[model samples]
Structure formats: C-alpha cells, structure tokens
Target: MKKINQLYTGFALAMMLLMSSCVKDLDQQPYVQETSASVYAKAENYKRVMAKVYASLAVGGQEKGDGNADLSGRAANAYLRIYFNLQELPTDEAVYTWGGGDALNPLQFITWNTTDEWSAAMYYRILYTVGLCNEFLRNATDEKISKFTPAEVAEIQAQRNDVRFIRAVAWSHALDLFGIPPFVTETDPVGAFFPRQIKRPDLFSYVESELKEVAAALPSRTQAEAGRASKGAAFALLAKLYLNAEVYTGTGKYSECVAAANEVIAQGYTLEDTYSKLFNADNDKRTNEIIFAIQQDGMNTTSWGGTTYLVCGPIVGSMNATERGVQSGWSSIRTTPQFVSLFTDVTGTTDRRARFHTDGQSLDINDVTLQTDGYGLTKFTNKTDAGGNGSNYAEGLVDTDFPMLRLADVYLMYAEAVLRGGTGGTATEALGYVNQIRTRAYAGSNAGNISQGDLNLNFILAERGRELFWECTRRTDLIRFGRFTGNTYLWQWKGGVKAGTTVNPRYNVFPIPAADRAANPNLEQNKDY
Candidate 1:
C-alpha cells in the first residue's frame, strides 16, 4: 500500500491558473480558453490552484514527463534543476560534465554572463512561482471567501498564509542568489504590472517579515502535510535567512538566527535514525525529519526534475542503476576531490552519511568534460526502504520528494549561529547539536563527536558540507564564509582553472539575466556581469 500524500493531487485541474514570466508580462493570458472570472468563481478550484503553486516549485510544467513545460523551450527551467546548478555548480561541492547544447559549464566554471540560460530560466522560474502565488492570493479575497461554506472558507484562509510563505520562499531565493531582484506582491497597483526592484536589505526584511507572519499563523509541528508549508517551515526559512543575514544585508543577525532555530528545534522533529532512508523513494514517510518538502508521486505527479535528477544524475551506465531503483543513469553530476576529502572514509562504514560512489570514477576532476574524473554521488535514490523502485521507475520518473527544509539543517544553523556570537545559545548546546548530527552520521555512536576546541567556524563550515552535501546549500554557505569568489579557497575547477584561482568578487551575486533586462525597462542587471 502506498502512502497517500495529497499535495499535488489537484494540480491537473489547476490549469485555469494564470501566471507571469517577468516584469513585462504580469498577467499573461491562460493557455486554456478560460477567463479569470469563470475559472476562479468556484470555491472548490481554490485548492487546485494552491496545488499549482506548490507544483510550480517541483515540476517543470503541467504535462507528464515534464513535456510541454510551464515555461517552454528550455528543459532546464525546472526549479530544482536550475536551482541545483546555480547553488552547487559554481562552488567546490559538485560539477556537471555535459557538453554541446546545455548551458551548464558557465555555472560550474563561474563565468555566467547576463545572457546565461540557466540564470535567465531561474529568474523567470522564481517570478513564475511568485506569479502563481500572487494569482492565488489575488483570488482568495474576503469577498470571495464569503461566497463559500465556513469549512471551505477556513481551508482557503489557511492556504493564504501558506501561499504567502511560498512566495516568501521564492523571494528569499532571489535575495540569496541575486542581491537585488525585482519585487512583486499581490497588492501591486492595477497598472503597475512592472515590478520595481528592491534593495537586498529591504528584500531581506520583507522575506523575514513574511516568514514571521506565517510562523505565527501556521502551526508549529513535527511535520507538515507532504507539500504544505507550516510554522516549522517558516521558522526554518527564517533561521536560514538570519544565518546569512550578514551576506544579504551586511548585518550579523546571529541572535535572531538562533531564536528562529530554537523555534524550529522546539517543533519536536527527531532525526531519522537511518540517514539513507530520509532521501529514498518513500521519503514521504520520513516526516519526522523533513519539515517541509515538495511532493513527487511517480505515478500521478511525474517530473524530469526534482529527485529524478538527484537519483539519476550521477549514476552512469557503469554503476548499477537498478540497485539504486532507477531504470537508467545520467552520469551528469559528480563531486570534486575537495568534497570527497571532507569524509575520512568515503565508504559508509565509518560514516553512514558518506555515500559517494567511487568505483570506475577518479577522485580528481582533471577534465571538465569527463564525468568519470570526479567521484559520483549517491545521496539520493529512487529505491524505497523495502528495496523496491518508485512507482514509475521504468519511465525514469521518481517518487522522492525534495526536502527543502529539514531538522538537521536547522540544527546546523543553530550551532553555527551560536558559534558566530549568537547570545541565546551556549557552547555546550551547540556542541550537543553538532554531535547529534555526528551521532547519526557515525551510526548511533559518539566516535565522531567533536570536542569544544574542535567546534569552530572552520569546523562548522566543513561539518555543514559533510552533512548537507547535495542539499543545495553550498554556494550560499561559501558566500557567507567569504570562500565563494576569492583566493581563500580552491577546488578542482573553481573559477574555471584546474588548480583553481580567485574569481572577480562581482561574481558573488549573479547578474540579472539579459533577457529579463531586455524585456523590462524597470529591471537593471546586478552591479557587474
């Protein structure tokens, strides 16, 4: 029997939802022959539209197998796929070796320009998500609520906060990736379809405010419904934002970060004892650790992005794809030796979290085009704990939900914030939190525990990479620690050199995509391209 996760169950009927691509098109007409009045008139369809908002973050489009994408022409427009590229590729954590057609090398090599495809697609994708969320918020008016039953009204009311939370999530990504990005809300003036750009600090405050509001409104719990954003999710996002506050706003908000982490840790989520089980096909059942996730059902909600990319990207033909529960392997993603060096033992015996696949793969990435030059990753898989493939494994689609926010990340944030001079937490507590994660990694033992002297900023940074590898937090983490675009740190191909060299500091925040700039006069590129 499969677990019933209803997060995206209503997405098929959400076709009536309208969306925008960028500043020039705030109200693009629906693809279907449906007017807003005719579509949003009913109360039942509200939930379906909300489902569309959630699906916007996970799937590429409305069509099956990610065909006929929501934003067409570019297959890399999927949120997780592009987000993974921007977050992981430029840093020392991971690399993509595909050539000829896809626009991925610039990401890994740190040479992306204003017209780069991945950044452009990501810009529109985030805005598209905001567009969907705005549409949902636009229709969830009090006037519309009065037309529905009280029970239905209650549900719609709750979703309004969730929608805001989701929108805040998109905006937060903008704040983190692109220092200053165009800002839009449901309350924009009727004619002001062109959104005004917000400063990085202001956008940070806005995101913080949205998270705080939702944190108060939504329930703090052990887990949210498969794809729903909850109070814990809000707190988790808050902690993440505050942890990197100095990078986004030039202000160290470690105390605030600790407070937010405290709230999330209080939500009663325990570590899933078996680390691998937390990311398998049946991860939906591991709600104890995953605070908020984007649901993916193999049979109903099939996608080429999301965990399908994670489970298949690194598994080449030489690797046993069937054992990993997918039909084929892409061999597209691999890690540099710097990342593999974080673990004393790449094998899982000493550290169960060290799940890198090294067979038929070189430990060093001497060439950017050879996938086998870097170590393959196995952090995510399409196999269920019972040793079975996902529901649609034969088709290469998967059921592994993307864990956007989890308890372990919160723990690391809490520990980091404390070590960074946060006031609310003690050193002992920080050490305890790190050891809690270490205990899990060391397979329920204390051998991997760190002493007080070993628990420093350097150790926290490495510990974060070790624990949260392939989780899409690397670039931001490096930027915060001053290691992203300078000579302080080097990986196999950092800044496009085999030995690695310093990159221009302007590369810290990606320039606004030239396509978006050309389309909208209101938008400006980041400080430099």
Candidate 2:
C-alpha cells in the first residue's frame, strides 16, 4: 500500500511533465482558472500534478540571495519560525526583540499578529499542492488517455495516497499553528471559497481519520520507491499525530502512539549509532536512521540547491577555517544558551559544551572557537569551498538530505509516550529508550537510570530539545507541553519576561494570513488577530 502511494506520487510527477507541455495557457493563468478536463487528459498528465505536489515540499526556508546579511533574514522567514519560537518567546529564556522588519520581530509585541500576506502565502501554497493531487486522482482512471498496466495502476493509486499523506502534514501544520482552518478537500470546486474556521478539535479529528485510512494501505519498504513515501513514514506521522492528540483534539492516544511506533519498529528500523553521523554529508542514503527525506542532488537536472544548509549555516564570524570562508548573509540562528548547556562530558571530566561554538575562522560553526557564545548552530555547517567566489556565502550546493522522519525520533517518542502512561508501561522502559539516543551521543547511559519523578513531562520536553534541536521539532514539542508561550530567553521579543512563566494562548496558534482574508472575505481572522 505504501508503494502504491509512492507510485501514485511518482505518476503525479509524470502528470506534471505532460501538463506542462500540453496546457498552452496554464503558465499564463491562475491555478483556479485552470480546468481539470483540459489538464488531466492522460496518465502522463496526472504525473505532472504529482510533480507539483512533490515540488511544494521543497519550498522551505533557505539562504537569502544577497551574500552578506543574516541567514534568518526574509529568505528564511516562514511558518517555521512560528513553530520554533512558539514556546521560547512567552517564557523568559528567549524573546522576539523588536527592531528587524522580519516577521519574527513582531512576535515580541503583545499585539503582534501574523501578517495576512504571510498567512495567505502558506495557505495558497498548501491548497495549490492539494489541488494538484486532487486533479491527478480525478483523471488518473480516464480511458481516453493511454491505459496503465495493472501494476502501474496500483502504483498510481498509492501515489495519490502519498499526496494525501503530504496533505495531512500541511493540514497538521496549519491546525497546530492556526487552531482552526478552512478544510478544503478535492470534492470542493476549484475556486470554491470556505468561510468558517473549523474548531481545533474538529480539525484534529479530520486529520486523524485521514491518516488512519491511508497509512495502513501504504506499501512496505523497497529500493525502487526509495526517497518516496513509505509505510514506515506513514506510521511515523501517525505516531506524531497520536503523540500530540491530547493537545490537538482533547484526547489522549498514548496507546495509539505505541501502536504506530511499534509498527515502524517491527519493520526492522533502528537508531543510528552516532548523533553527528545522522547529519554527516557523506552518509546520505546510507543512514538507516532516516525513514523519509526530501531527496536532493547538487548536479544539473537533479538539484534542490542545498536550501537547508544554506539557511542554517554560520555567518561571517563563525565559518570553518580550513574550508569555506565567511558567509556574510548568514543569519546567526544562535542556539539558546539554555539549549547549548544541555550537553555534558561523557567522561564526566572536561565540559564539551563548547563543541556547539564556532571560532572566528570561517562562516561554518564546526570551525569556530570553543569559547564563542553558543549562538551559532553547528548542525548544518557547510564544508565545501566549491563556490566560484572565494566566500563561503558563494558555495553553490551541499547534498544534505532534509530528514522528515528518522528512527531516533521513533525510539524517543515511544519512550516518552510510555513514560506518560500512554502505553500502560513503566518509566524504566522509557528511560532505556532515551538512553539509546544519549549513548549514541557519547553521553553515557546515565539517562537510562533516571527515576520516575525525573521522567516527568518537563524532563521529557528538555530531552527532546537536546536531541532534536534544529530538526524543526522543537516548536511542536514546546507547544504540546504548554511551554511554547511561556519560556523566556535573552534577545526575546517580549523583553524582561521571566523564563518558563508567562502565558499567551494566542501564541499557540497563528493568525490567518491577512491576504487570505482579503481574497476570501469569508475567511475569519483567528481571535485576537
């Protein structure tokens, strides 16, 4: 079933190519104006629609075009920050300081609202991708186009399922950030407008049902479907949904989390042995830790342009000395001192917390001095000096695959869920799961011996922060624990707020983009917007 989804998704890519060539005015007109009958004439045309779906996943934050500013500038700005700081700002540990014109700046203000333009852009992009998937499924069975082999047909259906999986992800993101969103499915007209904001609980139920229906039908792992959605990916996402079910839908699904996680575990996946190796550039496809990833190639005809690394790499002061020079445009997305202090010496001897710092050599964090303010994140350091210009900012591309799901996350989630009594299990088992990750980081197995009281939700949240920093999971984790709107740190937008004290429910969900409301007057702004 998972393979079927991938095949369908691949077929959608094929559809994209066909549609691109056949639709004379598609490029000239808005997507809503395009008709399904004109576009879905052939199996190949359905593939093109899938291509658009696949392409949408690639449009995350990246480095700005200019080479000398902060990496977190306008280019890296998006819904991601809303997730990242959702927890840190309201508390004392981190704040969104006012000054920069970027979206993050306004987060400091009590009256800060998500701009309509930003909200509309994300909503538009998500719907456009969903529309492509819907169109492909509608016309995929047409006999007028060249018929597909039984195997090909199965693959096409599977691909449609994968698109739904992707759609679920987009919806989940929106629901988490915006609380209630207009649920738009394929059955709705192309230009149909939805005015009501569905309640958060209702939206959560919808997503949960959608994932449950499709995940089971997904195919098992196979090399032919590598880099595409797999059964394991579906299960992993389902686990995530369950892990947060209580927060999203007012229902606890700990057993559901265990079931979903166990499905992946039973499929022969295991945590990678090393912490750093998971993101090491050379590992690529070899890292069994990854369950799903967006495949990226630096060469011609198969490139993703290294957006993740470009956006997260060090700036002018912290570049690696032996390799790429300083990145002037790099936005120093400094790791919070709180997060940086989590690492302890494995030998219980010298503090290696400095490993997160970058010396003033090049723009990469790996090459920085150990004593530097734990500001720069070393996770996505760019090593290649392959740019035409001598500066690190000019580095063309690095082939780091953006991980969507990996085994370590599964293990950790299972442990946390079990500890929370969701799986009706003991904390010892949960501790063991956490130790597996810690041991890999060379931090020893002390984490395995933690007591029940020490295994509280706060502890689990901190553990996740230490293990999953910059993996784009922190914001979600914080929000789930009710800490996203409470914690405080230096340079926080709401200055002087105490760490782990303040509370702002509005911060839990994003405002509907103003542009969306403008375009569709029926759309309502989230409360307090």
lDDT agreement of model 1 with the native = 0.84
Give the number of the best model, judged by TM-score: 1
Q: Give all TM-scores, in the order shown.
A: 0.95, 0.77
lDDT for each candidate structure: 0.84, 0.55
- Residue pairs in steric clash, candidate 1? none
- Locate the minimum summed-lDDT window of 10 residues in model 1: 16-25
Stretches > 4 Å off in candidate 1: 1-5, 16-32, 190-192, 222-224
Candidate 2 residue runs with Cα over 4 Å from true position? 1-39, 60-101, 107-111, 114-120, 141-147, 300-306, 309-313, 321-329, 345-355, 358-374, 382-395, 424-426, 443-453, 487-503
Q: In terms of TM-score, how similar is model 2 to the real structure? A: 0.77
Number of clashing pairs per prediction, in order: 0, 68
